[model samples]
Target: MAFPIRSAVAALCAGLAATLLTTAPARAEKQEHAWTVSAGAHAPRARITLDDSTGTLNLSVTRDGRTVIEPSPVGIVTEQADTSRELRFLHRKNRTVEERYRTKSGKRLDRRVRMHETRLSFATPAGARLDLLVRASADGVAYRYVLPAGHGDVLGETSAFNLPPDARAWLGTYRADNEGQFTEYTAATAPTGEYSDQALFETAGGYTLLAESDLTGTYSGARLAHDNGSGTYRVKLADARVKTDGPLTTPWRAMVTGDLATVTRSTFTDDLAPASKVADTSWIKPGTVLWTWLAGGRPAGQSLAAQKAYVDYAAERNWPYEAVDAGWYFKTDAWDTTDPDWQTDSWMPELTAYARAKGVGIIVWIHQRELDTPEERAQWLPTLERWGVKGVKIDFMDSEAQPTLKWYDAVLADTAAHHLMVDFHGSTIPKGIQRTWPHVMTLEGVAGEEKRNNTAAHLTTLPFTRNVIGSMDFTPGAFQRVGLRPNSDAAEAGLAVAYESGLQMFAGTPESYDARPLARDFLDQLPAAWDDTRLLAGRPGQEAVLARRSGDRWFLGGVYAGAARTAEVPLTIGSGRWLVETIEDGTGGLVRNRKVLRGGDTLTVDVVAGGGFAGIACPWRPGVTTCHR
Candidate 1:
């Protein structure tokens, strides 16, 4: 192991010496000396002040002299001791880091970040030493606590986000699906008993989004709870399942404060996570998959002929993955695995071999309960890996408790070791797992296409909420619209582009795609990863024009509900001419058009109520004015 840097260690050593050698009389004067640190640009300054004598740390963020995060108390609590009281001052250090890297999947193709960091060293009265790290960037501020090598098991930690008493928050309660409707609550009216892991607060100055990041195997997942009429939010760790003996670090409890766009665009969760654990990630391929669940239940889905049909469909579009959803290994009574007539020993090899011949990978689905024990996971995961299964979609986890959180880590660790990809269904929202384990292609946390029908308005709000933090298995590309929703082929095509996911599983069956030939081009061009993303024009619940680029090709689309709307989407497709192809809603299905577009061209798109449009722009010859319709 690399030795700790001498400079950083020196600071900590000095801090420990100060606390050990100082006389009791000097504590009175030390209380008055506040250690102040600042970060971010000149406009929006983020300041953290630590009172060494009292062991209290307070954070305040400001934009143009207006307060964003009020003087909020920032500290941690454990069964052994509370940092706010018994923690004594140790050495401190400051540093800066700059990075530019590509995201494996998500809205943006690449990320460029610069962070200024301050590390405060502290030693408990019991002689335990720890470090509290605060990192400030142009986007927001994030802080986390680090326990030294010999620190014992932890009870809990805190990242209290104390907003103004009058501030209102958009709170999402815990549920099986992360798509739980967000309700507004005032600080005075605390959401007691509500399970809110990610909370977005609307303060007087701007928005403050609080979330946890990089929770792997070391720590338990946490949610926030509040007392009625107190307006004070505290961190509630998942049960008492988490225990650490060696060196351990808690997840980063990030508090991002900014305007709507600034807050939504920040990728702090991904930034806080370590690099990819899968070194040779060449085998990790992400693409649209064909799911059999949305078509019907196992009666219509779980047969050899039915799966082969889906594989045939995947081959036609050159899609890499095809999911044989739940009940593939013999149908059980009423979706319960208790009385199972298992068929994996007999038929799985035949199906996998068949798919391999057609150059299509198979993903099987199983219930999380079935793999609750490590022995069960070890036995089945390796067997599936040997059978040439590319991935597994484990569902019905449905719990945010501490043990459940630990189970997720255990499953991912085993799956990654075997080079098998994973997709979590009926599970909690993603929290930077993709960066830590790139093999975790996607997670089904949102109210995806599996619901049969969804409004364009709800689709618009996702970009700012669910999709911002992590991968969403929002299974797009459903050509059919439910009820009297005025669905159009153009809108269906647009969704395939607008939404972000590592695994872009299409809900439409093979018959649906073959029925509408006009959408084939747009659907086939959908990318599993992107180089950059630009949110052209949008609000939370109105309309959205999202543009994403992969390589030199750019895909743009817009979705809206209610009344008809129009948007002028600007393009910066480098310094070259290109051919812009658009599929728009028409009287009969979709209307296709192609035109010559330059680097600074703006494409105007109009769609009726509950409608959308998708277009693609690719490089073209300078003299190409006449094109196919």
Candidate 2:
């Protein structure tokens, strides 16, 4: 499972070079060159234009005849030279890629992708070679840099996403851990600060999600920095320089466009990633996890008795896993687990055995400092595996630098060898890592339930911006109103369906969930991995309605952040009648109802500010009017 970095890069460069030499277009003059590539022969197409007429490589994108990205500069700056200008056009090769694959867990199981690609080779005056690869799909446009063979340092990138004058954006401040609040701002009013990798922009044409994908350990992660009064967001690396020995390729800078539905449901990020590396994925399981730390305080909450109770709760609800968070081990110093003074809780083996008897798995937490080195991982992972641990939650990475990213790859490979799934905490936003390592169940990169600022606006905005790129470990379904924002009981339940994660962590305690039988029943039946997904209606920071299907049943969830409003969601999943069961916010607690209706029927529900609803619809069967189990 170890990624052969050098071999993979060399193979990629060789394949690309062979394709260029075979089907490349005739060499054009160095004066000025331009070409346009469209997604496919169909409406709602995405078009990308590559132009170096002004002596600088620039690119632009349009969706269905409307401009989404203006002409912006694009190139990489290396230690040897600045390849942004004074480059000679070598040749251009065009091809079509048709791909179909299945995901271990995500918004959808089956995925089909078709893109028109153009590879433009260029040479600097100093004879250094660089290739720009552009891909256009029905939902978006992506571009990357490929250095066929090189031995230098990549200083930075000169890529800019230029937006129209009147565009507005939902932007999050840059943090190494990728946990922060996102705010809405006008293009002119956006603060001059570092922003996260993903940003959602509302343009005249439609919605455009600016993101990055296919990031590997070889390079540092990047962010977008905007200047006040300027609509251009330039790419900025997390580290000062990325050292490359040979055959280096940068991550893809992608922009997904269309209506809210298209933007929310698009899989452009995963499409650009490498396929799964695991040969046998039957051991990887995606399901709801009953987390202990969130319900009670740490150390005390992670006690053997408390964890055993959590395992019982998970077993009773048919949930597959129980997460035992930090404080299970004692260390005298950082990264000194091998010291004679260090001690690990003796109850872990017994707990794992007890949980296994009830058909529940145990996932233990470990600090990144404890498992950063290969020696440390070799000493710890096998022991945990021998204890029957199903997974590991590694925390406190808080970095996207090259070294930290490299450690991520090593840890994933080691854990995979040990047959253990992974859940990353205090981590960077997902850059298609799940596609490469299917055992990465979920990651904590958002201001989730643990933050006091987890407001209704934050919850609603996540689906379009953060959650669109990959699985998010938001840890929803909290009933205890403590330091978090005030939300209706139904809103908490609705989040279980609205949010998508391979390992969904419910944050409420056993007592809290037991008090509400209706909401508990809903959680018991919700599936973490989905077969299909659709966005019924939504606007960033305002409200959202999402429908997801698992087999023949469809689940609908909606949340409103502003004043009371009525959401009329159309049930267009299929062409037959359905028996629907719903739970919505009531005057006091929650209300449950049932009805029978056919497809295309509109279900209207009035939601108060900070309120929501959750429902399930099953295909109607003759002599069966109730939706049970």
In model 2, pairs of residues that clash are none
Q: After superposition, which runs of candidate 2 have C-alpha atoms over 4 Å from their true positions?
A: 1-32, 41-54, 331-336, 339-345
| Pairs in clash, predicted candidate 1 | 11-91, 15-90, 15-91, 109-530, 109-531, 109-532
lDDT tens digits, residues 1-629, model 2? 34698889989999999988866554543223776777754323433334445457888877667778888888888887787877878788999989998888889989998988888888876888888888888888899999866537889999988888679889889999999788999765789999997988888668899988888789999999999999899999988999787788999998888888999999999898888899889999999999887787676444888788889989999999999887766434343565553335457889999999999999888889879899888888998999999999899999999999889989989999999999999998778888889999899899988888677888899999988998899888778754465567877888887888999988889888988788898999988689999998788998888889998889888877977777777877888899888888778777887878888898788787788888899988878765658
Which tens-of-lDDT digit does each residue in 115-220 have in candidate 1?
8887888777787676778887766677788876655567666566677877876666666456665555777585576545677777766777777788865677
Best by TM-score: 2
The TM-scores of all predictions, comma-separated, are: 0.85, 0.92
Count of clashing residue pairs in every prediction: 6, 0
Candidate 1: C-alpha RMSD after superposition: 9.0
What is residue 486's positional error in candidate 2, in angstroms? 3.7
